[model samples]
Target: MNAKRKNKILTWIATISFGVISLIALFPIISLVISSLRPSSELMRQGISFSINFSQLSLDNYLYIFNQAPEYWAWYGNSLVISAITIVLSLFFSSMVGYALAVYDFKGKNFFFLLVLLILMVPFEILMLPLYQLMINTQLIDTYFAVVLPMVVAPVAVFFFRQYALGLPIQLMDAARIDGSTEYGIFFKIMLPLMGPSLAAMAILQGLGSWNNFLWPLLVLRSNDMFTLPIGLATLLTPYGNNYDVLIAGSVLTIIPIIILFVFFQRYFIAGLTTGGVKG
Candidate 1:
């Protein structure tokens, strides 16, 4: 075959392979969404199926979530607020730390970076006890602070940002400094704009992490009102009765923010990941 024709055939094969993989990945999500529209008894009886019974589906589950369950709204709000705060704060602090590690010379810098790496090696489960105790000592338990504080200096974010920042030209910093820009001014004004791709990537990751985080929030939040979506949805199941309709519907709804987030930042995702990969 001609080279161009051979390449085109290969590309077609790759496209078909990816398309098949995408459908395989999407099946569960599609099933969950279809199941959510079904009656709880129907779902329980039939389970998730390939065969569609359009007659049996309704928006009753969604309606029940909006009208009947005030707690669900509260939990939704809590997740939104906590995730927002966590994403913003984590980006701010992690980027700063990463930038410093990338560009600056200071005492204990290596030590701190080492500590971050060590922490990454240790599972969060190992730290959970000490962190909980620390929260108790500070009396931050059952508060939003408990949820947001520990996540602000995420190790992975720091490392990712540092790797990304390494690819940035230091000449910009020197020029800004020569122009008498303050350190913070240089970072916030000049460096930050250049770090857009990295920030976007981290924002999506951190936002998703905070949004879906259940264990830490479960431990820290004593009240139902403060529960994040994951915990709240989990609570839908009890020994007496299981609210499968609302649970499935809420699970479906929970996907919206992550989707919206990816849509907004997707333009930068590939660019950021590519840059980080090359630079690192």
Candidate 2:
């Protein structure tokens, strides 16, 4: 075959492959959304089946979720607060550390970078017992701080920022220094402004992780009132029975913030991922 015909065939194959992948990825979400709209009676009858009834849309499940399940609201609020704080604190500390690593050459710089790499390889599950014990000793259990503090120094975020910062020009810093800007001023004023895309991307990732955290929060939080969304959602699954509609509604609620954030900052998130993926 001629080269142009081969290329055309390859392009069509790639397009079809992407469409299939997109459908596979979207199927579960589409199912959940359709189920969320169906009446509880229909859902109970369907029971994991993929049957669809366009005429069965009802707001009762959502209304019950908000009005009847007060704990869901509390969990939602706790999750939101902790996740927001985690994102802010993580971004601030990670950016500072990443900036120092990226922009400066100091004694033990290589050692510290190696240490970060080493830490990154260690799983959080391995440290869970020790982290819980530390939290107990510090008397931070059952508090929002317990959830917020552990996640604030995210190694992943640090690595992401460090890599992103590598692409920035040293001349910019030199110019700022020559203009009598302090190191802190240069970082906060110049480096940070240029790092918006990276920061936004890290914030979205860290925020989602914090919001969905279950095991650590369940371990530290003893009271129902302090439970985040995931913990509270777990409570819905008792041995006695389960409310599928309410559960679906709760899951939908949990995802709404992430969807909104992605919609708002998708450009930056994509740029940040591209930047990190393409370089050190």
Candidate 3:
């Protein structure tokens, strides 16, 4: 084959491969949606199925979630608030920490960065007890602060930003300083814009993590009214009965914000993740 024909053939192969992969990944979402449309009787019989029985589907699940489930909306709003706060705080603090580590030559710089890496290496489960105790002592339990505080400075995010920042042009900081920019201005004005990919990548990841986070929030939030979506959803199942109709429908809706977030940041996501690792 000619060179042009060879390139076309390779492109077609890649397109077909990715298309198939996309369908496989999307299958769960499709199943969840279909399951939501099914009645509890139908769902309990076979569980979430891929097969369609148009006659068996109904709008009852959506109707119930919208009209009857006040607790569901409260849980959703709580999740939205918590996830939003967590994402904003995590990105702001983690980026600054990472930027400083990458750019500055402070006294214990290497040691601090080393400490971050060490902390990153340690699993959250190992540190959960101490963190929970810390929350309890601070009287932050049952408050949004309890969930948002511990995640504000994620070690992994710090590490990602630091690595990405290392690849940035330090000369720009010097130039800004020469032009009478303060250190904060130098970062916010010059360095931060350059770190766009890292920010976008982290925003999506942190948003997803916070949105799906069940364990820490479960531990901290005491009131039923204060519960996040994951925790609230779990309450739908009991030994005596299960509300698969509302649960499945609510679960499908839960993915909407995540889908919107990923779609918005997708262009930058791949670029950010790839570039962040390139430096360190």
lDDT (Cα, tens digit) per residue for candidate 1, span 1-280? 6999999999999999999999999899888888899988777766787777899889999999999989889999999999999989999999999999988889999998898778766778778889999999999998999999989998888888888888888898889889999999998999988999789888877887788887888888888888999999889876434688778899999996667756777866555444435434
Ordered from best to worst TM-score, the candidate numbers read 1, 2, 3
To one decimal, what is the Cα RMSD in angstroms of model 1 from the true structure?
A: 3.0
Candidate 3 per-residue lDDT, tens place, 207-280, comes to 77798898899889999899999999888876433678778899989987667766887776565445435436
Q: Encode model 2's per-residue lDDT on 1-280: one tens digit a residue.
A: 6999999999999999999999989888777777777776677666546667677778878988978988888888999899889989999999899878898989998888888778878988889999999999999999999988878888777888888798888799999899999999999999998988789888877877788788899899989999998998898775443576677788888877677877888886576445436435
What overall lDDT, based on C-alpha atoms, would model 2 receive against the true structure?
0.83
| True-structure lDDT of candidate 3 | 0.87
CA lDDT of 7 in candidate 2? Answer: 100
Q: What C-alpha lDDT values do all the predictions have?
A: 0.85, 0.83, 0.87
Better of 1 and 3 by lDDT: 3
Per-model TM-score on C-alpha atoms: 0.87, 0.87, 0.86
TM-score winner, 1 or 3? 1
TM-score of 1: 0.87
